[model samples]
Target chain A: QQPVQSPQAVILREGEDAVINCSSSKALYSVHWYRQKHGEAPVFLMILLKGGEQKGHDKISASFNEKKQQSSLYLTASQLSYSGTYFCGTEPGDYKLSFGAGTTVTVRA
Target chain B: NAGVTQTPKFRILKIGQSMTLQCAQDMNHNYMYWYRQDPGMGLKLIYYSVGAGITDKGEVPNGYNVSRSTTEDFPLRLELAAPSQTSVYFCASRGTGGSGEYYEQYFGPGTRLTVT
Candidate 1:
């Protein structure tokens, strides 16, 4: 099933923090995070496995809660380059994934 | 290396027409997928392949067919196109290892298709 994302849109000033949440009704095997700029393909950010591991790169990070079948993407000290739509794709036991409707994040300087 | 490439960046089709969207990866990834995204919406998986000669349907596979004769190429075919098929289609692939949980995908630029 497709996961559900909260706070469909986020607006933040530079150096501010924002959180986007994704939750699924069914158990998730893995959660993949991506960022897409206008008129461009989505770029992979990170993948959180079923172990509830929290992974980070630069100022961005994500956490997956296996028990809750949910994942959260954290934008720390947001920057202008972070302006884009954030998507969370959830995969069940199967390898195929179902993506949640994206959360549009606009970081202004 | 071109991580992933798609052909005919954009196209328009008439009702009942047919065409194929080509996808290729030079990374030698073993998994490929096709997804369609409507404006202001998330992508929906249409089809996927684990390897050559192994194809499977995803959540939104209707009105679409796919083939994977080689690991580097995966093509999606649309027959008898309809208006509802108009959307941006993306082709992605990832190299998986270990427990098969690290599937960070590489996506192509995408092809925008419109059916009238």
Candidate 2:
């Protein structure tokens, strides 16, 4: 089944912070996060395995709670380049990923 | 090296028409996937291949077909296209593994198809 994402859309100013959440109806083995710009392909950010772990990049971080069947993406000190759609892909089983509807994030200068 | 490439950036088809979207990756990845993105919605997996000659259906695999004759090529086929199938199609590939036990996928530019 497809996952559900919260906050269909969000607007933020430079240096602001935002959180995008994705919840799955079924159990998940791993969660993958991606960012897509307009008219472009989605870029992989990070992946969290079952153990309810957390991963982070320069200013982007994500946490996966297998028991909760959900994951959250955190953007710290957002930059203009961070304006895009965030999608969380969940692997329930069979190594197949079901992605969420996505969260549209806009970061203004 | 060209990470991933897709053919026919845009296309139009009528009901019952058939077409093929070509996907190729030069990174020699072992995993490839096909997904469709509708307006205002997230991507829906149509099919995926773990390696050459091995293919499997994804969440929304109905009305579509795929072939993985080689590792570098994975093409999606639409037979008797319908208006509902109109969407942007993307192809992605992931190498064997990532440095930290994660697999990062690289996507193609995508093929936009409109059915009239």
Interface DockQ of each model: 0.90, 0.87
In angstroms, how far off is A90's CA in candidate 2?
A: 0.6
Worst 10 residues of 2 chain A by lDDT: A91-100
Query: Stretches of candidate 1 above 4 Å error?
Result: none
Candidate 2: residue B103 Cα off by (Å):
0.7
lDDT of 2: 0.92
Clashing pairs in 1: none
- What TM-score goes with each of the models? 0.96, 0.94
Model 2 TM-score relative to the real fold: 0.94
- Tens digit of lDDT per residue, candidate 1, span A31-89? 99999998899999998988999999999999999999999999999999999999999
Residue range B9-67, candidate 2, lDDT tens digits: 99999999999999999998999999999998899989999999999998889999999
For residue B60, give model 1's deviation from the true position in Å. 1.2
> Residue A75 deviation, candidate 2, in Å?
0.9
| lDDT at position A66, candidate 1 | 98
